[model samples]
Target: MSQKPTSSENIVNQKYDRCLADLLVKTGVGFSIGVVASVIAFRRRAWPVAFTTGIGSGIAWADCDRLFNPTRGPGVRIVSQAQTPESK
Candidate 1:
């Protein structure tokens, strides 16, 4: 029989509170970088270039977010862990 996860694991899987904070911090760094680079590119009359730069940065930096929460990330899934129903 599979042992049930303690409150800690459920908390990790369900709420993703810690994971969110961690990702926000990690992603926020690169996000700032992206914003700055995008702004610079836009100032150079390269809107498409600026927009794509941020998208690329977001895709690349998103791995850090997956490192914290895999199954619950908005639309990105870099990890392959199976998501299970919350056991009562």
Candidate 2:
């Protein structure tokens, strides 16, 4: 039989959900900007500018998520310290 999740697991799950929501928001903002920029560039007949702007927007959006998330990405770390016999 499967055991129920503990409090720590619940906290981790909540953090993951929050992070996912934040990422979704970031993605939406980036996609919206990309669409607007692409439309303007297309109207101006600037195909290269439109293409690059769309790609860059997507990349920047993902980067924001990676840079800001503390529970995931490069932010995960562990620290350890040794105790002297006297201290113990």
Candidate 3:
């Protein structure tokens, strides 16, 4: 017997799934582009494929990082409350 997943668990699972999907799509597209470039422009060199694939993976990683840590992303500001003299 197994219990149902909690809300937090579901959220985490969804995020993980999204990240995985992004990784696959981005990397696959990059690989395809790299193959074409290698064949047409790079004289069938292997580096273009590897380089483009790496770029795709890097993009996916940045997107995943933002999803997991929204506040830590670019242009996010954190504000702190000021204490009153009476409270202090």
lDDT of each: 0.60, 0.62, 0.93
The TM-score, computed over Cα atoms with residue i paired to residue i, of candidate 2 is 0.46
Any residue pairs clashing in model 2, and if so which?
none
Q: Candidate 1 — worst ten consecutive residues by lDDT sum?
A: 44-53
Q: What local lDDT score does residue 28 receive in model 1, on the 0 to 100 scale?
A: 59
Q: What TM-score does each of the candidates earn?
A: 0.33, 0.46, 0.85
Residue-level lDDT of model 1, residues 22-60, one tens digit each, is 556655565565567667755544554555555655654
Clashes of each: 0, 0, 0
Ranking by TM-score: 3, 2, 1
> Which residue segments of model 1 deviate by more than 4 Å?
1-15, 41-88
Cα distance off (Å), candidate 3, residue 24: 0.3
Cα-lDDT of candidate 2: 0.62
lDDT of 3 by residue, 1-88 (tens): 9987679988999999999999999999999999999999999999999999999999999999999999998899877665434463
